[model samples]
Target: MAGKGFGRWTVHGDGRGLAPGAVVAPDERLSWPATIGIGAQHVVAMFGATFLVPLLTGFPPATTLFFSAIGTVLFLIITAGRVPSYLGSSFALIAPITAATASDGMSSALGGVVAVGALLAIVGLVVHFAGARWIDIVMPPIVTGAIVALIGLNLAPTAWTNVQAAPFTALVTIAAIVLITVLFRGILGRLSILLGVLVGYATAWIRDEVDTSKIGEAAWFGLPEFTTPTFEPALLGLFLPVVLVLVAENVGHVKSVSAMTGQNLDDVTGRALFADGLSTVLAGAGGGSGTTTYAENIGVMAATRVYSTAAYLVAAVVAFALSMSPKFGEVIATIPTGVLGGAATVLYGMIGTLGVRIWVQNRVDFSDPVNLNTAAIAIVIGIANYTWVIGETRFEGIALGSAAAIIIYHVMRQIARARGTSQEAASPASAPAGTELNRGEPQH
Candidate 1:
């Protein structure tokens, strides 16, 4: 038997009282029935989120499911089957996808997303070898928090806009989520997001808002239509700016997963990133949009404490099975946008709150001029100049806000250091222990 580590598990005897180094084989605790049940739960929890990017970006929902399933499996294999991380459709790429698609077509937008995923893998490798401290220095909470808040704040308008189309339906959906989340306890509360979606979907059905006619029209089972990249200059130019933003978002997600698993994940970060990158490439090739790590699933992990890699494996298999079935995909597609809007109201706000939580956890004091200026200015600049232009190409939306946050935060940090009283104090050599200057390690 191997000793237990933070992220890695050790084999143990089944109440046999064996000594150390005793060998024990893996068991089938998650029976077939249980596996299917748990897997279905995961699917339901993430189904809405998984297909959302395609619907928003004008890509095929079936293709999204295909890559998502493949991505989840790849992540499991790359992480040495230790981390129970779930890779599904990511909301982070929505801004980038929208920007890229507007400039070029869906193909080019997908290529950009693939590039972003590759960048994430590279950054993950650096973090793995160098350590989490490097991430802290590069993307401090001040910067990350601002970007996260901006991500949510920017999407606020869109959420409201969608709801405005069907105010009553939206309200009913929102109320359903709130009622389930607040009124229910235990497992029910944990599944409030899914439950809320169900209620909103039911409401849409009753109101004749859902269009099931297409569901029956879709094929029962079909192959995923793949698309090849053209590498057009205009598309590449437009996508470059947003790539950095998506990469930044990926970093935040990796950090969140690390915190959830109580594992540094630095050792296998590169591999995990590679999985994400490759998945995007696969998605693009399969006529889908960019794929990213699902944050909602991370929340599920935290709430359930069910960190089992097997569960995700089960989910991947199920997702793949559904992807090959057009009828199933169409059923998922019928979920009303108004319902999604209402659920997003909660999720988007929660994402912002998570950013605030990270800031609070880091004990960031806003009273300090340096801290306050960095946070406030970054957020304001991020929202204000939330658009980018270069030559004939342009990138806008969440990407702009995310990039602005990073740039502003760095500039503010530099200004704070420059205004210090003493040269030594301002210099990295004189920095206090455990500060970013020392890469988060205590000095002897």
Candidate 2:
């Protein structure tokens, strides 16, 4: 099992230059030096969003990095190194964590994380035994796309709030990201988010927006802090929704890799889910944030055309090394609200766009009223930030929107089919393929 993660990669080419249209496979690597360089690039790719989750949610950034590194390794091992992915802090869990922390304390939030992880793990075990067909049945392309889209859109207000804090800095950061993507190609283009963050950070400092006292006070090296999870049954509702998002993320990851590598990674889908759930469980126990397969690293793989698990293992090592430094974590923590706002504005929209990509890639027929209505209703509920509270438990936009999508899709589809009206007339809501509505596809 250890060998699966570390020793099985065959060298790709002369370990120097990648030929045009060439890709390095998960089980293959370039030379050690080249591989290490790519691994470092992976670290940079995951850095922005990985740290952002913890910073936004009040978790220890170092702890999140530590578990993220460990989680990536575990994912590789569980999938037998067949799938190329990097597990990082999941944004889906942020809302639940915040609510739980507010209601009961951080310990209760950790407990919620554990419960969600356990639930996801159980789902994985079921998928492993029964196969993943049920996932598709429950969440067709329409529902999946809507759920994905709404989660991103729901977070837009948060981005705006941060942007309002430092509007000028936010604009600089957003502009930097936009310019960087077009100005450069290869790894640099893929690293636009990290680069833009640096640009924004510099701009913030110049504008006296960042507070660096914490960085100076932090120690050079130490272990990340750990916390004990205290499960509160009442808070469980706040986190149950995240399980659905995580499942969507994991399945989409497997499918994306399958599409890119031309390999049938379906067999490892359950393992991927289980690995992520187990990683989250470990993270909650250690005071880190819940983990997910990161799309940022997927972008790096696409840009560099290197999918070697070896590089991911190396990336994990680098993250682990960095997490050992309290000072490094503090430096990340000191990034100003404006810089975060700028980055989030771009990043969150891209996430919403990803849902549309899923639809386009799958050729979802939105003309079917079932599909159109599902998305229309769910997206509104999510973007409008709908809220419903029951006693001490609360379900907000993401949770409600997800539920609405799933329920609406299934109910509407079943009725349409039963009534022999599945093929509805074309409507403006359905756009042709290759149009502005349906063009790009998600790298993840």
Task: Output the number of the TM-score-best candidate.
Answer: 2
Q: In model 2, what lDDT does residue 127 have?
A: 88
lDDT of 1 by residue, 21-119 (tens): 222211111444434444555676577778767788777777788888988888777667645556776665666577767777777777776666666
Pairs of residues clashing in candidate 1: 1-21
* TM-score: model 2 vs. ground truth: 0.81
Question: lDDT of each structure?
Answer: 0.62, 0.79
TM-score of 1: 0.77
TM for every model, in the order presented, reads 0.77, 0.81
- Collision pairs in model 2: none
297-332: candidate 2 lDDT, tens digit per residue: 655665566789988999999899889998876776
